[model samples]
Target: MNSKVINEIKIKDGRVLTLVEGDITERNVDVIVNPANSYLQHGGGVASTIVRKEGNIIQEESDKIGFVQVGSSTITSSGILPCKSIIHTVGPRMGEGNENEKLSKAINSCLGLCLRKGFESISIPAISSGIFGFPNDKCAKILVNETISFLKNLEDSSAGIKLVEFCILGKDTLQAFQYEFEKSKPEF
Candidate 1:
């Protein structure tokens, strides 16, 4: 729960892009995206932290969904966390095929799933930038770009998402996302 706001961008549709230096497990958004393995295993990095805080039930439900393809995602009810649900997404490893494209697809898929579930707000970490070894700056650029693109495509406020947060961990990741957000935000 030690998260503090680092930065924020208000999109044209009234939605927000937030950058926070904190633990996603403590975020109170409607959903929190977990960067998980295709097997839905919560064994390391942010995934492990989430499982440690939320308990085994998150993994139990994920196990039912079994395996998810890289760049794809699925959802499960939050076990003990404050959020209502968790969206587990499989992110690509560093040397995986077309790492950048796979990472972008993974984030877009997570956001798409959240919208379909009617979630108005979600907190996401820097997927694949941790144990998956994707570079923080590259991760920042792709994630922030895809997020802005997704929000800009919303036809109206009723698209169901009003907030998308990059609940990043580590000072380096936080800075990376912050820089990307600043660089991409519209000149107003």
Candidate 2:
């Protein structure tokens, strides 16, 4: 983690959390990361949205990566998605994950790729809380915490990212990450 150059730290800067309720599939960000399965193949929910929008090339590119694991990820071009790139991050499966640790890593993987891709801005929907059924609060906590943890200490602080927005679809979720991210380090 770089930790020096600030890209999108909400608490550190003067900005409050940007929680928007809208369709993530159509948002125009540098990259719209997907909460994908290890197979990288699209199935349902957000996964299906990426596949349906990006065309068949997404699955074709994903096939080259083989099966990824929880907390890890892979990337493929968005064949038809509105964004320039599609980062496929495999979030932890419901109950099968290591509670907090693995989820943290998963969040990092997504953020790390954003930097690696030279993208300073990105958008992510709720990961693992839909069909994966991991519970919304826990998912938001892991995502916000791990994202803050990584961005705060990133060595590649020059990732050029100015914003990392979470385009949440519902109010309950918007409140969750906004709350956790507002907490002090040991407040949890």
Taken over the whole model, the C-alpha lDDT of each candidate is 0.91, 0.71
lDDT by residue for model 1 over 1-188, one digit each (tens)?
58898889888768899998888989989999999999998899988898998888998998889989999999999998999999998989999779999999999999999999999999999999988999999999999999998988888776689999999878888889989988998754
Q: Which lDDT tens digits does candidate 2 get at residues 1-188?
A: 11121122463332222444566767777788888888887888888877886678888888888899888877788877678888888877777847567677777888888887888667888888777877788887777766665655655444356676677766676667666655623311
Q: What stretches of model 2 exceed 4 Å from their correct place?
A: 1-17, 155-159, 181-188
Q: Which runs of model 1 end up more than 4 angstroms from their true locations?
A: none
What is the Cα root-mean-square deviation between model 2 and the actual structure? 6.1
